[model samples]
Target chain A: MTEFLQQLLNGLSLGAIYALIALGYTMVYGVLRFINFAHSDVFMVGAFIGYYLGHHVPESTVWGGLLVLTAAMIGCALLGMLIERLVYRPLRSAPTLNVLITAIGVSLLLEYTGQLVFGAAPRTFPPIFPSANFHLGPLTISSNQLLVISVTLILLFALRFIVMRTKIGTAMRAVSLNPRAASLVGINNDFVISFTFALGSAMAAAGGILYALNYPSIDPLMGVMPGLKAFVAAILGGIGNIPGAALGGLLLGTVETFVGGSEWSTYKDAIAFAILIVILLFRPAGLLGKFTVEKV
Target chain B: MDWPLTQMLTVKNLEVCYGAISALGDVSFSIAAGRIVTLIGANGAGKTTALRTISGLLRAKSGHINFNGEDLTRLPPHQIVARGICHVPEGRMIFSNLSVDENLAMGAYLQRDKARIAQNRDYVFSIFPRLKERLTQAAGTLSGGEQQMLAIGRALMGDPKLLMLDEPSLGIAPKLISTIFEKIVEINRNHGLTILLVEQNARLALEISHEAYVLETGRVVLHGPSPELRTNPELKAAYLGG
Candidate 1:
């Protein structure tokens, strides 16, 4: 029972990271109805931003850690907005297939460009926050795990307040519901779309910094595996549903962690894909997604 | 016939196309301030297209749209809306996922003045008390008539100088249609708001409007005072089901 509790705690902390990244996918999907394939690369960029900024800030302090996270988030937010303006905006009225192909291209571009600039060798991520281990009965919980979970909770609440209570957030929802109608009501759809990109990218950046705090190893391609898992999480939660993404991330992370702790640890990665197939077959619209018939 | 009112909107030689298919061909019309003008036509006759182009949802391929002495031919939809022209589109495109209150708040998206927005909210509630009653309800759950009322009420919250309504009578219960039309008249008369109404119900459109334009296959076939167009034998046969 103690071991089970330990694994569950670890699973939830990892799940918190996935939830942060999944939010970006879900939010972009909500407003633009397309998967931003380059989002994972943006995550990698966030880690590198932190790596560079880590050199300047005092390590092992709360304020220093937050500063790195904020800088990474802001950098990635601007990058996300730039991507939308330069690439996606031109393809706004084009076919979905064209956009999908373009997204894959952008992802590859970011990956190879990252390799060129940052080098393909992996580097150790500097400790940004103070670390400690706590023993509760027979369970051991690391301070980094606690930080990940607490930060995710706070960010989630902030996101909820922005989306549910703020004017721009309401406009975002309106644009998602009906773009033409939103425009008729004096909403600049372009500005709203750009804002969605910035918001999602910022969350992904936060996820990147949090993930590095636990793993300590960073590389240009580090985001690919976690990015894929978070994409699955977003799909599991229903791509355009906000709370659904968080639920899906937690559920996926818990399941994957349990599988890793078992005898079939070698097959842990396969488990996520298998679950995706099962979900696609049984509930293609996702766990919380509403099935909607296209209007003619 | 038009002695007092100033020209509020003018469209000259406006042509709009979808790919190669022309939706509006040489459509020209003018609306006077503080008066209701109706464009009555068949489904394919470009009435909705005219309203859409005027509100800058669709760009005109050639020609000009001048609103209150300023050119609005190339402006985007949001900018046109900011310039005090609000469009209540067909099918009553309310954001169904949002509450009735949120929908009304969205209509005031461009307004910065708190007191003015509050006043507009009150005015909307007074015009459609049913909307006020369902303020927190999801807009999609409202009845067809109630949804139409919300659409009009939402547009009114924008504090528009010219209100363009497309098919306010469509898909609504017969009993509630008259009530909605009465509210439209009441809004125009009480507020002196200029209106450009497009409707498939020619009889009802003619009854409520002061001036009427008859459209057929993307061209204006006739234009006259509402009473004169109401009595025209050709218009009656084509549109009034005579």
Candidate 2:
């Protein structure tokens, strides 16, 4: 039972990272109705930013860690907005396939670009927070795990507040419902789309930084696998639903962690794809997603 | 009433096209301040297209739309809204995911003064008490009539100088149609709002309108006062269904 509890904590901690990354997928999909495949590359850039920032700061305190995280989030937010403007803006009226292909192309561009800039060789992520292990009732929790969970909670709450309580957030939802109607009420949809990208990318940055803190490895291709899993998580939660994405991420993390600790450890990545398939078959709209008839 | 009153809005030789198919061609009309002007036509007669063009949703291929003495031919939809032109679009396009209050809040998207926004909210609630009762409900869950009311209410939240309502009577229950029409009259009378109402329900639209224009296949086939158009034998046979 204690072992099960231990695995649960590990799973939740892992899920927190996935949840942060999945939010970008779900939100961008909500507004644009297309999966931004390059989002994972944004995650990669975030980790790289954190690595460099941590190296320069060299003070592994919690406050220092938060400063690095904030910096990474801001950087990724601008990067995300830039990507939306330079790449997706021109293709706003184009067919969905063109955009999807462009996204994959952007992903490759980021990866190759990162490889050229930072080199293809893997670099160890410097510690951004001092490590500590706390044992409570036979369950041991690492400082990184606690940090990941707490930060995830803070972000999720902030996200909920923004999406539900703020005026711009209301405009965002209105745009997602009907862009023409949104513009009729004086919403600059281009600005809203850019803002959505910035918000989503910021969360992914936090995910990237937290993931590095726990795993301590960084590379150009590092985001590929985690990105795929997070996409799967978004789908599992219902692709366009914010809360659904978070729930799906947690569930996916738990299942993957349990599996990884067992003899079928090699099937960890495969498990995500498997769950995605099963979920698609059973509930194509996802666990929390309602099946909506396409409005003509 | 003067035949040619002071014009609040004017469209001159406006033409809109979807590639090769012209949706609106050489459409010219004008609305006086505080007058309810309506465009009555068949479904593909481009009535909605004219309203869409006026509200800046569709760009005019060649022509001019002047509103409140300013040219609005090339402005974006949001900019047009800023110029006090609010369109309560066809199909009652309310945000389904948002609450009734949130939908109204979105209607007042550009309004910065909180106090005035509250007054607008109060006005909306007074006009549609049912909306106030269901302030927390998602707009999609509203019945067709309620949705129509909410759409108008949302538009009113903008405090528009010129309100363009597209098919407000479409898909509404017969019992609620009269009530909605009454609300339309009350909105015009009390608020003194200039209206450009587009409708497929010619009889109801003509009955409530001060001036009426008949559109057929992207052209204005007839233009006259509502009572004159209402009594026309040819219009009665064709549109009013003799």
Candidate 3:
């Protein structure tokens, strides 16, 4: 029972990170109807931002850790907005296939640029927050794990408040639903699109910081695997559904952790892909996604 | 026949094209303040194109669109809406996922005063009490006629000086059409709001409008008082179903 509980805790922490990253993918898809393949690289940039910010602040302090996280989020938010304004805005009326290819091109550009700038060697991530291990019976819980879960909960609630209660947030939904109707009702669609990119990128930044807290290894290519997995989670939960992404992340994390603890640990990564395949074959609309017929 | 009425909107030799094909060519018309001016035509007759151009959704190739002495030719859709021209687009494009109340709030996106928003909401509720009852319901779940009501109510929330409706009766039940038209007449009569209506239903549109323009292909082939156009032999044969 304790063994099961330990794996559950570990899975949840990892899943929380995936959930944060998945939100960015899902939100961008919701507003623009196109997958931002470069979103994962934004996660990598976020971690690097935190790593640079961490050196300037005092380590092992709550305020210092929060400061690093916030600075990274704001930095990535600006980067995300810049990406949308410079790259995506020009192709606003272009075909979806063109946008998809551009996104892949962006991903390659970010990756190669990151390799040139940050170097290929992996660096140790500094301990931005105080760390401790707690034991309850035979099950162990780390402070880093607690931080990841608590921070994700707080961020999720903040997101809900913004989307449900605020005007700009409502406008985002309006734009997502029908861009033409949105403009007719006086919403500036461009502003809303930029805001969505910024918001999603900020969340991914938070995810990067939290993931680095657990893994302690920082590299330019690090986001590739986790980013792919988070994309799967977003699809599993239902792309464009906020709560769906979180649920998908948590479920994928738990299942992957359980598989890793077993004899099939070598195929842990394969497990995520397999689940994706199965989901695609069966529930293409995803668990929470409602199938809507296109209205003529 | 002549009243000292100021022209609220004027379009001179306006032309709109979609890529290589022209949607509206040399379309010219004017609307006086506190008048219901309608553009009646069949499908693909440039009625919707004209309304869309006036609302700034479509760019004009040539000529000017002046609304209350202000040139609206280069303005964006949101800016045109800010200038108090609200368009309830075709097919009652209400945000189906959002609650009816939220749809109304989006209509008042430019308005800042909280009390004024509340007053506008009250006015909408008074006009369509059905919308008030289903305020919390998702707009998509509403019946077709109810959706039409919500669309009109949503526009009214903007406090627009000129309300342009594209096919208010389209896709609605025959029984509900009369109710919606009665409300349209009531809104124009009570508030003296300038209205630009586009409709495929020629007979009903002519009965309600003060001035009418008949669009064929892309250009305005005829324009006169509603009563005069209703009696024209050519219009009757082509549109009023002989």
Candidate 4:
């Protein structure tokens, strides 16, 4: 039971990071109806930003950690908006296939550019939070695990409030539903799309910070595997459904962690893809996505 | 092009095309302030296209759309809406995922004045009491008639000077059709709003409109005061039942 509980705690912490990255994929898909392949690079950039801040700040307090997280989020949010304006905005009215190709191109551009600038060497992540572990009845939990879970919960609640209770969030939902109709009622859809990118990228940045804390290694290519896994999580939850993305992330994290701990750990990555294929075969719209017939 | 002083909206020699196929050609019309003008035609007669062009959804290939003294043909849809032209589109394009209240809030998105937005909300509620009852409900779950009402109510939240409705009567129950039309009249009368109405139901459209235009294959075939068009033998045979 203790071993089981230990695995559960670890899985939940990993899942929290996956949920944050998944949110970016799901939100971009929600409003734009296309996968932003460059989003994972944004996650990597967030980690780098957090690393730089950690080296400069020289404090291991909760407040210092929060300050680093905020800086990274803001930096990533700006980067996301810049990407949308430069690459995506021009192709907003283009065909879906054209946009999809452009997204893949953007992904490559970011990856290569990151390689040139950040170098190919993986750097150790600076510890921004105090090192502590708490033992509860035969199971031990690290402070980093508690931090990941708590930050994820707080960010999710903040996200909920922004999406459900705010005006811009309401406009975002409207634009997602019917952009032309939204425009007729005075909503600037381009502006809303830009905002969506900013918000989603910020979440990804928080994920990056939490990920660096847990993994202790950061590199230009760090975003690749996590990005793919989070994408799978988004698809598992329902691509455009926010809550579904969160649920899917947690579930995927738990499953992956369990598989990695077993003798067949070499097949951990294979399991996610296998589950994805099975889900697609049975429920193409995803666990929470409602299948809609296009009205002619 | 110089529009008449009384005209709230004027389309002069407007042309719109979808690639090579012409959707509208030299479609010209004018709406007087506070008057309900109806565009009646068969399917593909370009009634919806004309409205879409005026609201800046479709860019005009060549023409001038003069709305409230500004040239609207060149502006984007959101700018057109910001200039007090609100379109209640066909198929009742209410944001189904959003709650009725949120849908209404989106209508007044550009309006920063809290008090006026609140007042406009009250006005919309008064016009469609059913909308107020389901304010918190997702718009998609509402009945078709209720969705139509929410669409109109949502438009009204923008506090438009010229309200353009595209096929508001299509697919509605006969009982609610009259009620909807009556409410359209009431909105025009009470709000003193200039209305540009497009409808497939020619007889009913002519019955309530101050002026009417009949469109055929992207051209204005016939136009006059509603009562005059109502009595025209050719129009009566083609549009109203023989």
Best by DockQ: 4
Candidate 2 chain A, poorest ten consecutive residues by summed lDDT: A268-277
Which whole-number lDDT from 0 to 100 does residue B27 have in model 2?
92
For candidate 3, give the docking quality class from DockQ: high
Instruction: For model 1, name the residue pairs that clash.
Output: none
Reference contacts reproduced by model 2: 0.92
Question: Model 2: which docking level applies?
Answer: high
Q: A212-287, model 1: which lDDT tens digit per residue?
A: 9899899999999889999999999898999989988888898899899999989997986797779878999888
Off by over 4 Å in 3: B1-5
What lDDT does candidate 3 reach at residue A119? 96
Q: Is candidate 1 or candidate 2 better by lDDT?
A: 2
Instruction: Count steric clashes of candidate 1.
Output: 0
**Model 3: pairs clashing at backbone N, Cα or C within 3 Å:** none
Could you tell me every candidate's TM-score relative to the true structure?
Answer: 0.98, 0.98, 0.98, 0.98
Candidate 4 lDDT by residue in tens digits, A1-296: 78788988899899989999999999999899999988998999999999889988866788889999999999999999999999999998899889889988888888888889988899999989887999998999999999999999999999888888999888888888888898999988999999999999999999999999999899898999999989989999889889989988898898888788888889987985787779878989888888987564
Clashes by residue pair, model 2: none
Report the alpha-carbon TM-score of model 2 versus the true structure: 0.98
DockQ by candidate, in order: 0.91, 0.88, 0.85, 0.92
In angstroms, how far off is A10's CA in candidate 4? 0.5
Give the Cα lDDT of each candidate. 0.93, 0.93, 0.92, 0.92
Q: What is candidate 4's local distance difference test score?
A: 0.92
Regions of model 1 farther than 4 Å from truth: B1-5
